[model samples]
Structure formats: C-alpha cells, structure tokens
Target: MMRIGLILAGGQARRMGGIDKASAILNGRPLIHHVLERLAPQVDQVLISGRSDYGSGLTVLADRTDGPTGPAAGLHAAAKHLADVPDCGLITVPVDAPFLPLDLVERLCAGPLPAIAHAGGRMQPAFSAWTPVEVAAQLAHRPAGAGLALIQLARDANARTVAFENPGAFRNINSAEDLAAAEADVD
Candidate 1:
C-alpha cells in the first residue's frame, strides 16, 4: 500500500499575529521545511494542504470552499484527491509541528485502518493515518450540521488511538512564545 503524507498548513495562524506559520522560521529553517524533512522519508509522496507551495515542490491542495472550514477542509481536499486512487493511505500532520516523531507513519499504521496519535492525554487529530476509501465514505455520509471538525470525524470513524510516549514530540508552534521554546529545544 502506498503511504502519502499531507501537511496541514492552511491555518491563518491567528495566535501568531496572522502570519503564515508554514513560513515561520524555526532553527534557521522554515517550519514547513522541518516538517517535510521529517515526513518525506516516511511516505511515497507528500502533499501540502495550503494556499502556496512554500517552495517545497510538492503538490499544494487548497481547501474546498463548499466544505466546513478549518483543517477539515484541507482533509476534504485530500480525500477528493485520493478518491479514485487504489491501495493508498494518507498520513496527516500539522505544519507547525516541527518535532514530529520520526516513526509516526509506521506507528500509526500499526493500528486500525484509521488511527490517530494519542499523546499528552489527548487525540492529536492532525497526526493521523486514514484509509482513503473509508475517509471518502465518511465524508459522503456526513449529516447536515455535523460541522467540519476533524475530531468529530475521528469519533464518527471510530478511529483507533495509538498511544505515544513522548508528548513533547507533538508540540505545536501556535504563538511566538511557542516558537521560541521550540527553537530552544532544537539542537
């Protein structure tokens, strides 16, 4: 089965003064660069769910206008791309998570068809592996007023929660202070 990586980078970064989080600098490189460096080797192809490529050379999928907004829209766009594809699965991660685990895909794939990382006693919905066929089916059958929340989708899919030991590995850079702290941790 082919494993594809999808980096969710379309967020407005409202907490970071409305800047593009993907382009934000971290340890001398753009945040997306760090995410790509970690995720590239784990998948066959990588796609960015954002407005711009951010110079990553991978295909950038824009969120669907008709779907519920936020990260779910990005996932919706990805699901559309994977609709006709065969034997392929999507592993998603937030662009701001520069410290993503190196074995994320392998670990997530170890669980059910649709599994999400569970760390810090919470479901990290952005860090998940999804079966495209299942995702498409779920999206199609979504009821009216269900809203475009990924966590809700995960619950409806009965997504397995793969517990991860290192919660810090899932740190998200949502603010300048968070970015500074992450920078301090980078070697």
Candidate 2:
C-alpha cells in the first residue's frame, strides 16, 4: 500500500502562548521544517493538518466541523483528503515532535494495519500508522461534539503498539522550555 505522511499541526498550543507550534522556531528553523526533513523521505507524500500556511507548499488538511475535534480531527481531515486514493495508508506524527525517528514509517507499517508508536512504556497515538478507511469508519462512530481522543480511537481499532527504543526521538516541543532543550540537544 502507498504510504502518506501527515503532520498533526492543529493543536491550540496554549502552553506555547497560542502560537502555531508548527511555526515555532527551534535551532533557527520552524518546527515543521524539522519534522518534514525527518519524515519526508520515509513516506511517499507529506500533508499538514493545520490551517496556517507554513510556506512549505504542503497540502494543509484543515479540521472539519463534520468530524470529531482535537488531534483525531486532523486524522479525520487526512482520511477525507485521501478518500479517493485506494489501497493507501497514512502515517502521522505531531508537528511539535521535531526529533521523530527516521524509521517511524517503516516500524509502524511493519506491524498491524493500525499501529501506534510506543516508547518509554507510553503510547504515542499521534505517532501512528493507519489504514485510512478503517480510521474513517472508526471516527464516524465517535461523538463529534466532545471530540474523540486519539488514544481512544487507537484502542477502539485495536492498534498494535510498535515499541521503539529511543524515547528522545519522540520528544516534542510544547513550550519555550521544550524548544530550548531541543535547541541545546541539536547544538
């Protein structure tokens, strides 16, 4: 199946003072740039799940009122965007996660149809791979008002947890402190 990557960049980022997390600079570059650099080579195509145009020329799949809210909404938008594409799967990683592993797509695809990254004994639902059809179907059953959590959707789909060794590779920039740490790590 053709694999497409989606960067979940639609968070409120309240911790980051309402700034778009994707545009937040880390090591003198936008966080999305870092994510794309690591994720682009691993998948056939990349899509951003946010309203803002980061000037990266990526197709931004914005959340829809028809779908559940939160991170799952981003997945829903992506699934709808790929509705015409047959026999394709989607691998998603958060835009804030600048240090995503290069082998993320490979590892997730190696497992079941729906697989989520598990590092440091915690499930990283945003860092997951899914069959777009299955994800859409599961999402349709969710309540659109409160918004379904990505973790709950993963559990409902019986997503396999693909264990990864390096927990740092999944580190995400949620605040200024996290960005500073990431900057230091890069330096």
Candidate 3:
C-alpha cells in the first residue's frame, strides 16, 4: 500500500513545560531526529505536524481550521494531504514518542486497513493508520478535541488491534523524567 507518515508534533506540550516535544533532546540529538530516522524508512514520505519548522527538511502541516484542536488538528491536516496522493494510507505517530518501533508502519500495515498500536493493555491511539478517504469523510463528525478519535475511527472501521511485544517502544517523553529515562534506555 502507498504510505504517508505524519509526525504529530502540534501539541501544546503542557506536560513538558510548554516546549516543543519534537525539539526535546534525546541522546544529544533532537527527538525529531530520532523519530524521523526510525520512521522515514517505513514510509514513502514524512510530514511534520507542527506550528514551526522542525528543521528536519520534511514538510510541516499546521491546523487549518479556525479553532485549533489538538492531535486532531494534525490528523485533519495529514488526511487533507491525501488529496494529492490517490488511494494512499496515512500513518500517524506522536512526536513525543522517540522510541517507536522500527517496524511500526510495517506492523500497522500488516493488520487491518485502519489499525492502532495496542501495548501495555492500552490503546496507543496516536500511533495508528487510516484510509485517508474514509477518515476525511467521517472526520467532520468527530470532534476536533477528541484526541483519541482515531481509535474510535479504527473500531468503527473494524480495525485489527495489533499487539506489540515491546511496550517500551510506545513510551512517550512527556516530562523531563521521561526524557531522562529514554536517554538511559540508549546507554
């Protein structure tokens, strides 16, 4: 399947002290670098959903609607990007999670048409995939504020829930402690 990947970085970053999570340092490199390095090879193209340029040389998308929601904003923008790519799929990963699986897109694409990462007995909704056409059609009905709307959309599409063996891969760096822990994971 044709794949389009989006790094959802348009967060308010309240938990991380209002700093851009993608800019957060990990192992002396920006978290965006780590994420892009792992995710780029898994998809045909990569777009960053952020207010400012991530300085990673990838296209950046911002919330177009008047009242910006949260993750949904990025979701909308990414889905809209599908207008140019016919019959393609969109895979979204949060910018805060630098340790995403190298096979994330591969594993997600192996499941259902619209799928999500289920680890640690919880649904990692942000780490998901969707059919751009279907999501764009029903996206209007979904509240912009519903960050987990993709999970709901996945279920609505009868998506296959893929269980990841490595739960640590889904860890999100939401705080300084989380960043420190991720750094330690490397050394």
Best by lDDT: 2
Highest TM-score against the true fold, candidate = 2
Clashes of 1: 0
**Tell me, what's the RMSD of every candidate?**
1.5, 1.1, 2.1
Count of backbone collisions within predicted model 2: 0
lDDT (tens digit, per residue) of candidate 3 on 44-163: 998888876677778888887632267767878887877777878789998888889999999899855678889998999899888777677667666555454556666776777888
Per residue, candidate 2 scores C-alpha lDDT tens digits across 32-82 of 999999999999999999986599998988898888889998999899989
Residue 74, candidate 2: Cα error in Å is 0.5
On lDDT, who's better, 1 or 3?
Answer: 1
* Model 1: per-residue Cα lDDT over 92-164, one tens digit each: 9999999999999999887577998999999899999898888777788554334577888888899988999
**CA displacement after TM-score superposition, residue 58 of candidate 1 (Å):** 0.6
Judge candidate 2 at residue 22 and give its lDDT.
90
Q: List the residue pairs that clash in candidate 3.
A: none
TM-scores of the candidates are 0.95, 0.97, 0.91
By TM-score, highest first, what's the ranking?
Answer: 2, 1, 3
Against the true structure, candidate 1 has what lDDT? 0.89
Cα lDDT for residue 24, candidate 2:
93
Q: Rate the local accuracy (lDDT) of all candidates.
A: 0.89, 0.90, 0.81
